[model samples]
Target: MPDPHSSDAEPRPAHSAPSSLLSRIKALLRPAPPADREGIRAVLEAAHDHSILDGESYAMISGALEVADKTVADIMVSRSRMDLLDVSLSLTEQMRTIIETGHSRFPVYEGDRDNIIGVLLAKDLLLTLSDHALDIRALIRPPVFIPESKRLNELLHQFRISRNHLAIVIDEHGGICGLVTMEDVLEQIVGDIEDEFDDEDEKTIFRTGDNSWRAMGTTEIEDFNDVFHVQLPDEDYDTLNGWLAAELGHIPRRGEHFQSQGLTFTVVGADGKRARWLHVQRVSGASSSPETHTP
Candidate 1:
């Protein structure tokens, strides 16, 4: 009020260049903080553009932010795709499934798949090896049920506190819709993390016999072409499974087949939304020998 242009009238706070990324971000948002996700995104994009945050860190942080907005239903394995165990099955039969599926844990149901009673750990079955008198039900751990609408951030908190890796998702009417796992949540932040069961380098694509080969659905389109020496035209799609789904016009089911780009892709194994494994056969008369695509 005394002098509008005088520096002495109102001593302004010296805005020194922020030392750390956190300080820089705080400095950028100053008096008005981000209002919503989009506002936060704007601030993050600004930081990203200014080289305040590196590519990897920005991607992970952005993924974590995305997790907060998503619900369990977004990434959950659908109820139909869940590999559940039948409580009525004999121990021998259960062991077969455990061996085949390569899953560490399975949800055990009584009469119906919807009637999930508890979870069974594959390691727990080893207890029956030494002690033949142990009851099967005794090994079953209580199952956790979560609402599908529950935010992934809250679910992640619950997973951390309860140490429960898996939780059954239910609808508003208490109907089983799907299941979510800690791996699923973690993948959202850090991208895909491979386990022991995941396809290894050479194991990604295996030569079955003759002109047929077995390939994991996650196989990269480029890898597939490199192995078979054929151009599959990966313009929009990245993975073979993704491209197959688009060609089929829907999520491929086991036994369904699609022919494209001089190849026959048969869904050998599949879940609700994606193919797990595929049988690929060279339909065109390519000069490449079958031995070339081995492994």
Candidate 2:
């Protein structure tokens, strides 16, 4: 009989495999357990509870998962709020608008916002000032247009491949509805990303008295609740302004006051449509309610 372990033994057929190979084949024969969203969420929550992941990390993971179901329409800057430049305006005038907005880029339009021709990068305009003869149009980059319904994940991928920072969101009728930026998409994943323009010492909610506080319209509902030690419903809205809007059935204008959840929200500063700053005060001896609101 030949020694099976000996190299000198007759060579086995090509199809015959070693014992270690057979073990790997056995391992491959077993299928992995199927995983669903709920299972993944549970795992994440467990990790969070064990402190394997921080709260911010958990929130960002959840946001990343949530973004897959969101579209450009959800977080886009509405047309009314967009800072635009008219191509018909003189370079000096356009520079003034750019400086006032403190924006690095602006959509250039021929006649109106609807007639957007291209994007004008602020840095590109500097070169024009140095060389007065340079055509402003030559510096304009072709605008990227995306459908309002396009999923954010797909948009992010397009942004990566195209190297574009902003895209004009178009409605079904082929009209510009709003604009979305790379920052907007990333904000969803990593929470708010403040720029240099943001006030470093600005407080979202400032205590003015024993029970009175001045809060920014953009202050997150959770932060507001933590600061006031109140249980405010946050399921329907994220910001104080959004909650006020939902309560009032419309965006509250300046000088408007809405009472809800044992708190009185007074719009102290606002533009035509959205509230900018609000004065909040707790109603003495009043019980909190989830749905009760008075205008």
Candidate 3:
């Protein structure tokens, strides 16, 4: 055996990694089940704090618990932003909108946006090109209308049973309010769900509209500042998502917006635990001057 003080000896780890996480959890809850949700969450949190549970596992578990309390209105895409396909439009017009949105599916409307007729899959359009006699209406699948007040847990159950991926949301007066997707519900439990719109490369931000941009939450604050020519404080946070959470006093959620230094920060993509993407736009006549924030 080598001498205990030998400099050439490989240093042993101060301690071995903790035992299997399941065993740790079982030990923590050996006597009985937690009396309530709060009690169960407290135990989970304690384990998380002690490093027995990793951050991703902790976040997902917490998110699953939270979904039961959230409503459709909490995360649905608002009416004004929905990409509705107008049935009256010519094939060219419909194709233009669909390509621009880059969505796999859209809600079909008859006359008004509120009068949603059905759902249309982008892939369904390929047949239209080949069959000149096909009616556009024939391509639509029945639209599912859900009330904005509907609970997310119930909605998720319905989605699974029906195998429908999208639903139109309506207000109490039966007017269109927004839309929801299966991906949206799943996101609450599994973090960001990558889609056709998401770029996995070094391109962290993309121009969405005139003077508006979409950026990943993980984009470096420095990169964002350089792209937009504005100074957002990078002293405290490495990513824009971190700063937004601190600014909002919690993990940023979808559809939440805040105005700061003449720019609007709207969280467009987020799960239950963190912002995945954000839409940032410069307010009209707003100057991109050097700015400072106290928090």
Best by lDDT: 3
| Model 2 C-alpha lDDT per residue in residues 248-292, reported as the tens digit of each score | 888876556777678888775554456767778888877676445
Q: Candidates ranked by TM-score, best first?
A: 1, 3, 2
TM-score of 1: 0.66
Q: After superposing candidate 2 on the true structure, give the runs of residues whose Cα lies further than 4 Å from its correct spot.
A: 1-34, 130-135, 199-295
- What are the lDDT figures for the candidates, one per model? 0.79, 0.79, 0.82
Residue 13 in candidate 2, Cα distance off native in Å: 25
Candidate 3, superposed: residue stretches over 4 Å from native:
1-32, 129-134, 202-295
155-208 per-residue lDDT for model 3 (tens digits): 999999999999999999999999999989888888778877677577888877
RMSD of 3: 15.2
Models, CA RMSD each = 9.8, 10.3, 15.2
Compose the digit string of candidate 1's lDDT tens values, residues 1-295: 4787887786655654444666878888886889899998888898999999988888899999999999999988777668788888777667655654556789999998899999998888875866555556888999999999999999999999999999999999999998888988988888766655566665687765677777878899998889877777689999988887776777877666676556777665565668877778878664432222111
Clashing residue pairs in candidate 1 are none
lDDT: the better of candidates 2 and 3: 3
Strongest candidate by TM-score: 1
- Model 3 TM-score (2 dp): 0.63
